[model samples]
Target: MASQIQYADVEVGTELPAASFPVTRATLVQYAGASGDFNPIHWNEKFAKGVGLPDVIAHGMFTMAEAIRVVTDWVGDPGAVVEYGVRFTRPVVVPNDDRGGLIEVTAKVAAKLDDNRVRVDLTAMSAGQKVLGMSRAVVELA
Candidate 1:
């Protein structure tokens, strides 16, 4: 386990070390297997493109889950997360070829919500467009 981040250490408007998680068809399929979210739009590019999207779309929850790695890693434990939510602002399209569409996720401490908690705002992008936005979470510190 990593060293615990003390509550006194964080300040309002501080930024967390950002992270990036790439998305691909295989990852979407793997996530579907592990998370039980096997939406066709996540893995089937043809089906997605047929429906008018640029390509296969990553699952909304899948994107959120990957982005949480940055927060949980920074906070040093998953248990530190009090609440997390994100509005699906855009679909993260995964290209069919190898390497797929890479999602870049950056986060910052938006505010000190309470004595032991801070609100973290996240932004995820892919293909030079916003894939996830208005993403916020509350984390408790030791």
Candidate 2:
């Protein structure tokens, strides 16, 4: 599918819609099962805390995927993304609670590239702490 977003309509500093993802213990468990990443740190609070983490944490890949929804949602086509990468800066601690953890993502057009493409920079935060660093995606626009 072609991107609904047009390159001519975007600017270097334009902001895309922000997104928030709710991540609970159940969410982590589901992701673990789906990805075959049944790591103790992601599902066992005791194991996580024993390893010096505050609590069971979300998987890095799951967090990365959640963060990029902002870009995919904005572009209106998931395949429009040509490249995406991020550095894991901190863990999204998921405590055993009703509220759980929230991943807040905000993105902006970092640059207007050639060939109907644009670079989007993303910031992902959880528990008021930045979890992903240098998060960026190169997306093709119609």
TM, every model: 0.92, 0.98
Cα RMSD of predicted structure 1? 1.8
The candidate maximizing lDDT is 2
Q: RMSD of each candidate?
A: 1.8, 0.6
Cα lDDT tens digits, model 1, 1-142, are 2328777888877888888788878888998999998878888878888889888888988888988888998978898888898888888888878888777888888888666788889888877888777888889887
TM-score of 2: 0.98
Model 1 scores what on Cα lDDT? 0.84
Candidate 1, residue 15: Cα displacement in angstroms equals: 1.3
lDDT of 2 by residue, 1-142 (tens): 5999999999999999999999999999899989999999999999999999989999999999999999988878899999999999999989999988999999999999999999999999998899999999999999
Candidate 2 global CA lDDT score: 0.95
lDDT against the true structure, per candidate, is 0.84, 0.95
